[model samples]
Target: MRTQVAIIGGGPSGLLLSQLLYTKGIDSVVLERRSRDYVLSRIRAGVLETGFVDLMKQAGVADRMEREGFVHDGTQIAFDGEMFRIDFKKLIGKTVMVYGQTEVTRDLYDARDAAGGTVLHECSAVNPRDLDTDAPYVTFLKDGQVHRLDCDFVAGCDGFHGPSRQAIPTDIRREYERTYPFGWLGILSETPPVDDELIYANSERGFALCSMRNDNLSRYYIQCDLSDTPDDWTDDAFWDELKRRIPDEAADKLVTGPSIEKSIAPLRSFVCEPMRWGRLFLAGDAAHIVPPTGAKGLNTAASDIHYLFEGFDRHYNDGDSDALDRYSEKALARIWKTQRFSWWMTTQLHRFPDQTEFDLKVQQAELAFLRDNEAAQKALAESYTGMPY
Candidate 1:
């Protein structure tokens, strides 16, 4: 179908873009390869920056979230069995809300349905052509039938592995990547959290995080070998590893139950530029992906969409292409800053088994100094909660 924008991938980026454009009197359709249930029920990260909450509220989708989501003023960093809290209010005058990505997607899905918006699931996109050229269409396979969709512009929010990037001419794209030696073994448990605030712990074993989704559910992650898979660890093994990494004074407090979900996420920092080519634009994972250590993935995607909508507004309403032309450079500035922060946090917290004793001691000393130094603590707080964007 013809529309103002043809959005690929109905994840947070694509869906949110459609909603934002819809409110601006623009028409768009979202194409998703997964069912609504899969997107809604999937256990994803659960931290929302203050700006993110403001955007959602302005979009008129924060009613249920305001009631159901948990708000936290700060997070704790623990090492050597000692905990240091960074007060977000004192640091940035903002607090983050603990709300899972699943809930946000579900709310957006319901909003789209109620607004009579289209979200095509289980439809695989083959090749999306350029709008500047003669062929401006998206080819997809649906119901065992190949269909061609013509649209005014395309928004490639399909993620890092999706076909949207493959549609780009290789020579025009410059890709930058850095893969970490370790990955995260993430798990969701039915047990309540061991602590009220999220904890980032550094120990001899590795890095461990204790976070909660709600009163009844908890989420945890531990550093694992990059090549490790979900099947590599049993439930007991997982708990043992977690205990070794997570420092706890209360022996029986960090309790866990049957894991509802388990997955291995490889750590990587990547960026593909420029984010625009001809009439096609890219946002979210389609454009860049930062390591999850800083919890900037979803928030970055939302910021990308915000800037994109501004560009679209300038182009369509004011007949100004300046914002569209500068979108990539503008977005990438915030992107690389976050990428460095995430990488810094990752390196500081996670221990590499191959490192010498001297290296380990250096890292430990750095952490210890940062814990006591107000300047360093303020720096971490600024990066963790975001500076302005």
Candidate 2:
């Protein structure tokens, strides 16, 4: 098989990139290690930065999103049993969309299918070969048979554990990672949200976030020990812990229901410098991962896709390789800033195992500064809504 680009993942990043490229008459093939059902089954972050929403629009998959996704003009921050709102629209003149990552993947998959794009699910042992050369190709196993796909370039949107990043020689690939001591124990429930907008709370026990997929489906999370597992907490126990971390007002109105999905996700900030390796370009989790505190996991991935698509457009249509040449630098520049924001948010809200009384006071002081100072709020709002592309 031959294609202009061989995408080594069928997640939102890979699917979005392929769909976006298709609009420009670029052809690509997406390979997924799991079945389509498995891919869509994973629940992820729901917040969408303005930049990601625009990318969805550009990819021609915004019909459902614009119709169903809620527009969040601001978010709430709670500390010391009190809550304050940060008006993103008022401070930064922009807003974020509350759309599930699952929905985003579904829309991209639908668009890809409608366009008759090639998306090979259950493709295993995927490997990108000769990435440093002009003739790059990908090989994978399917149905007990091995298939090779020749392409002009390879897109490593296969995520953190995928083969794309591993294909880069260790001598050339530089990886940086910081794993948090805690994890987020999240649950999805069919109940109205506790608040109109998302609430990020820092309490004496831990950090909690109240987010929603729609008006009816709520997603909530509370900080937990890394040793904890989903099976350790019952539905009632999870709700009780969450209520303890949020403000009394929200807790009073909080609706409890049977949890539809539950999981514990470890927080980490990881980045692989130089997202591009010759004809192979890494996008999304293959290049970097942020702690979910600032909701940059998918948003940063969209930014990478944005840059990679621009590079491809310039190379194929305008015959300019400048963007392609600087893909790693440009993508990394934006990614590091995002990592910083996510790290700062996580540090501010989460209670570390080693946190002292002084440390707690510092976190309180920082939150207080953000609550009282307009400049600080504006800065938080800018990062929360997203930095410019």
Candidate 3:
């Protein structure tokens, strides 16, 4: 089989890229190693940056999101028993939407199916071959048979552990990574949120975040040991810890319930440089990863897709290869900025294992400045709502 672009992943990044290219009259095939149901069942961040929302609209999959997603104008930050709100709309005339990644994937899948796009699920041993040459192909096993897909270019959207990044020769690939000493113990409950907007709290005990999918489904998280497991805490215990980390007033009104889903995810900041290797290009987690504190995981991936799509569109429609040539430079410039923001937010909100009294005081002062100074709040709001794409 032959296509203009062979996408090696069925996640949001791959699906979004495929749908976008299809709208432009480009043909591509998406290969996934897992079932469609399995992909949609994984719970992820619901906060959507403005750029990502616009990309969804451009891909013609924003009907459901516009109808169901909630618009958040601002967010709350709590520390030392005091809470303050940073208004994104007031600061920058912009806002973010609360829409789950699962819903976004579902919408893209529906659009792809309606357009008769090719998406193969449960294909194993997918590998990219001849990435350094003009004629590249991808091979995989399906139904006990090996198949090859030839394409002009290959898109690696299979994520951090996927094969696409590894395809780049070690001699050419450069990686930067920083793993946090803690993890986030998160839970989903069928209850109303403690506040209308998301609350990021830093307390004496630890850090906690109050977020939600909708009015009836609340998602909460608290800092935990890197070695901690979901089995270490019960529903009631998780609730208690979350309450302690937020302001007393918000905790007083917090609703408690049984958790429907629970997990512990370690935090890390990672980036692989030079996203493009000859005819092969990497997008999303295949090329970079950011700590979830600033909610940049999927949004950064969307930014990569934006740059990649622009490169492809220019190359095919106008016979311009400049965008493709600068794809890595442009994408990496933005990825590093996002990494700094995520790292800063994580450091400010969480308690480091080696945190001293002076460090605690400095963190408190920083939060105080953010609350009292307009400049600081605006800076935070700008990064939170996302920088220009």
Candidate 4:
């Protein structure tokens, strides 16, 4: 089989790129290693950045999101028992939508199916070949047979553990990574959220987050040792820890219930430089990763797709190659900025294992400044809402 672009991932980033390309009459095929149901089963972040929302609109897939997603004008932050709000709308005229990543993926899949886009699921041993040459293709196993897909270019949106990143030769690839000393123990419950907006709390006990999928579903998290697992905590214990971290008032009103989903995710900040390797381009987790503290994971991936989509659109529609040539330089610029923000958020909210009294004091002062100073709040709002495209 032959296509203009052979995309090696059917995740949201790759699907979004394919859908966006389709808007301009570009042709592509998405290859996914897992079944559709498996992809949908993976729970992820629920916040959407303004830039990501714009891309969904451009792809003509924002109907359900607009109808069901809640618009959050700001988020609340807490330290000890005290809490303050940073108004993204009031400070910067911007707002975020509370929409789950799973929902976004589902919407994209529906749009792709309606458009008759090719998305091959359960594709095993998928590999991008001849990446350094102008003619690139992907090979994979299906139905006990080997298949090859020829294409003008390949998109490696297969994620961190996927073969796409390893395909980039070691000599040409450079990676930066920092694994946190702790992880986030999270639970999803069928209950009303503690507040209308999300709350990020830094307590003497640990770091915690209060978020929601809708009025009836609440998601909460608390910092835990890296070695801990979901089986280690019971439903009631998780609720108690979460309540201890947030403000007393909010916790008083917090509704508890049986956890439908529970998991522990270790925090990490990672980036692979030069997101491009000849005819093969990387996007999403294949190129970068950030701590979940600031909820930048999926949004950063969307930004990569934005740049990749623009490059493809220009190459196919406008006879322009400038954007394609500068894809890496441009994407990394924004990626690093996001990395810094996520790092800042993680450091300010979590207790480090080796942190001294001075470090704890500094963290407290940082939160205090963010709460008391409008300038600091404005800066937080700007980064939180997202910088420019």
lDDT of 1 by residue, 219-299 (tens): 999999987899999988998888877666622588878899999999899999888887788899998898888788998
Ordered list by lDDT, greatest first: 3, 2, 4, 1
Is 1 or 4 the stronger prediction by TM-score? 4
lDDT of 1: 0.83
After TM-score superposition, what is the CA distance of residue 214 in candidate 4 from its true location, in Å?
0.6
Which segments of model 4 are wrong by more than 4 Å?
none
lDDT of 4 by residue, 225-320 (tens): 988999999999998888888899999999999999999999999999989989989999999999998889999999999999999999989999
lDDT for each residue of candidate 2 in 1-389, tens digit (9 for 90 to 100):
99999999999999999999999989999999999999999999989999999999899999999999999999999999999999999998999999999999999999999999999999998989999888999989999999999999999999999998898899999999999999999999999999999999999999999999998899999999999999999999999999999999999999999999999999999999778888999999998989999899999999999999999999999999899899899999999999999999999999999999999999999999999999999999999888998
Deviation from native of the Cα of residue 5 in model 2, angstroms: 0.5
lDDT of each model, Cα atoms only?
0.83, 0.94, 0.95, 0.94
Model 2's alpha-carbon lDDT is 0.94
- Model 2 has a clash total of 0
List the pairs of residues colliding in candidate 3.
Answer: none
lDDT, residue 382, model 2: 93
Backbone collision tally, model 3: 0
Go through the candidates in order and give the clash count of each. Answer: 0, 0, 0, 0
List ranges where model 3 is wrong by over 4 Å.
none
